[model samples]
Target: MPRRVSLPSADDLFRPTSPDGSDRSPGEAAERPAEQAVDQPADQPVHGARPAPRRPSGRVRHDEKMTVYVTSEELHDLEQARLTLRRTGLTVDRGRLVRAAIALALAGYEQDGEDSALVQRLRDA
Candidate 1:
């Protein structure tokens, strides 16, 4: 007789992750983390007034996957950046670095609109 292996069900694999209601109030789904929501620099806009620039969900196990192909030059640059960060005592894998960079570009676009570096670059491209 062969032994069987147990595998996760579809529901288990695709569980609700965004502010899972287990510990949070219903309204918390619409709110940012307390620290982010609480501290409003006078220079910065309020969270609600403009949808708070989407921040990176750091250090969590991501279930979804996205495949991106880059040139050898780009790959070399990314590796160099990873090494530089390691030298500075910050260790993060390439995926985490890419995600952080994406978050930064999105946040810049959201906050600065047409004037953002992301938007300017896209327009230039």
Candidate 2:
């Protein structure tokens, strides 16, 4: 008789990782349609008014990859910030934090152009 291998069922394989039922793979969010993932009113105008605040894609899908090199001191600072936020019960990863920071900088730049903090910092650097 051949030895039969028992494989886990699809349900078991795809079961949520968290007990509270909020577990989701990071890439899963990328699969969602923007209309479904983001809550926008049907009546809301798509443009003209000041754009909505640029919110970081927290726990959502990030399909693109970006590589940034940071100095040791900068890395330490990032870890420190992550730890500090963890202490406050935010529990965010470095990537998510970096995304949020990028969103903030981009928003600032969009609103301020050459007068933005990002441009000023780059100039100083």
lDDT of 1 by residue, 10-116 (tens): 98975655654233344564676766556555436766675656767666656578999999999999999999999999999999899999989988887888999
Q: Tens digits of per-residue lDDT for model 2 on 15-114?
A: 7655566555666777777886786754344778876667776775445899999999999999999999999999999999999999899889878999
Residue ranges of candidate 1 with Cα displaced over 4 Å: 1-48
Q: Considering every candidate listed, which one attains the maximal lDDT?
A: 2
lDDT of each: 0.78, 0.82
Which portions of model 2 show Cα errors greater than 4 Å? 1-47
Reference-based lDDT, residue 4, model 1: 100
